[model samples]
Target: MTTKSIPDILRQSLESHMAEADLRDDDELKELLGKLNTLSGKVAAAKAQVMARRSDKKR
Candidate 1:
């Protein structure tokens, strides 16, 4: 069996959320996209930290 990492799981969930929000009206979609963007940035930052830590461990 194969296991997916936390970051991969989070990325998938974020993509799904964004896809669903895309079907809404313009105003509502804009608001949702803004929030999703903020969340995605934060998640990317956190994922970077995790990757850095993993690299450090390998050194």
Candidate 2:
């Protein structure tokens, strides 16, 4: 992955950690975790698009 993807990579790590956390009644953290998960999906899609573009350039 490139440097541009670093932040998303970090986000993914954070999302994972948060998911593993025991936030029973923390609505704010719960909402944040959901948002992070959604954002992570977008980041992954963006990364895939970037990789595809790179491959196309090679061809």
Candidate 3:
């Protein structure tokens, strides 16, 4: 089984909402997606830092 990251799950949920939404606005959707992408990058960076710290402690 494959694990899905938090951001991926959130993005999927947001896209699903957009698909089912009647009041679709292009600019709003784009902005939301941009924010999600930024958050995803931050999460990735944090995870990497945590992993690096763990590796250092193991040495």
Q: Best candidate per lDDT, number?
A: 3
Q: What is the C-alpha RMSD of each candidate to the true structure, in Å?
A: 5.5, 4.4, 2.5
Please give the lDDT score at residue 14 for candidate 3.
Answer: 82
lDDT of 3 by residue, 1-59 (tens): 44666887888888888788943758988888888889988988888898899999999
Ranking 1 against 3 by TM-score, winner: 3
**Per-prediction TM-score, please?**
0.54, 0.60, 0.74
Tens digit of per-residue lDDT, candidate 2, span 1-59:
34645445655666677678733436876576677668767887988998999999999
Where does candidate 1 stray beyond 4 Å? 1-24
Please list the C-alpha lDDT of all candidates, in the order they appear.
0.67, 0.68, 0.82
13: Cα error in model 3, Å: 1.3
Model 1 C-alpha RMSD vs. true structure (Å) is 5.5
Worst 10 residues of 3 by lDDT: 1-10
lDDT per residue as tens, model 1, 1-59: 44555545655675677678845346865665567667767777877898899999999
Where's the lowest-lDDT run of ten residues in candidate 1?
1-10
